[model samples]
Target: MTRAAVALIYRRTDNSGTQLLFIQRARREGDPWSGDMAFPGGRMQPEDASPRATAERETLEETGLDLGRHGRFRARLSDLITRHHSRWRPMVVTPYLYEWKGPKAVTLNHEVEHLVWVPLDFLAAEENQGRRPWRTPLGTLNMPCCRYQDYCIWGLSYSMVQELLAQGLP
Candidate 1:
């Protein structure tokens, strides 16, 4: 089965410049991306009218922020397809960009393990660039990663950040 998923790439601006919200997924045994840092989102549900709605809905459910009420929908960003094919189900994800003025507080739901506000400038720093070890059935290999303090942002989360940067937002 092919699934459609959506994510919200939320940015906040103030006197301190801009920062993005990233969440660490809670550890779950069967989840492929468990404990990974990612934008708040998930598979599309029946009630979601479109991919945007899916993003908005998931954002609310995961972060307790009603994007419809709190965020200014900017523009739709890039859509990413699953690079590694799965024998079971595959997914395509569309990300929506939303900007919030001033500062915002996040109240994470159970689906999230932790939340980190990633400073835009930190991402551009050369020191933040590193590699993370990814273990597969074959062996462990180092994958490109961005580190902030103790949190390591890599894989799809890193790719999404690249897309957002490519749009000339920061």
Candidate 2:
């Protein structure tokens, strides 16, 4: 019934090249994506003007990093296909891509148990490639995944990363 937005903040280092930010969710029971690796974001609020604002707000709330203070806000990517949760109705997720030029330590909130900076080149590596079986209301489906460090970034997050890398990377 409603839509959400997510921010995919990435950094380009002179030596290491591009790196994407991934946050490890806290081990909370009854959460669909519990203890999984994900980007910084959540559902849009009524006060937010647009999905972009929702993304910025959620990123700040989850990661404690201010895009306005650290990096320049870049272009917003096209909206991904709408995903529906069992409890909630169908919702569209619009993902935004922001590039941080300078380097700074990341501070994650309690909602995030750990944080990782994954190299872009390793996204499709052997160790990162995996599969996840999901039984949604639509039906049973097998989803491809990329696990980096200790977090398994699969499903919509993985799909978003794949699309962003394909369309936004230079």
Give each prediction's root-mean-square deviation over alpha carbons: 2.5, 2.3
Q: lDDT tens digits, residues 1-170, model 1?
A: 34455554556455666788888999888777888888888778778898888888888889877778878888777777773333545567787778754236777888999988888888867888899999888999999889987788998778878777767774
What tens digits encode model 2's per-residue C-alpha lDDT throughout 27-139? 88788778888888888889999898898888888887787677577777777766554455678888888887654766677889987888988884677788878777799
Q: Could you estimate the TM-score for every candidate?
A: 0.86, 0.86
Residue-level lDDT for 23 in candidate 1: 89
Q: List candidate 1 stretches off by more than 4 Å.
A: 83-87
Badly placed stretches (over 4 Å) of model 2 are 82-86, 135-140, 168-170
Candidate 2's displacement at residue 78, Å, is: 2.5
* lDDT at 54, model 2: 90
Task: For residue 62, give model 1's deviation from the true position in Å.
Answer: 0.6
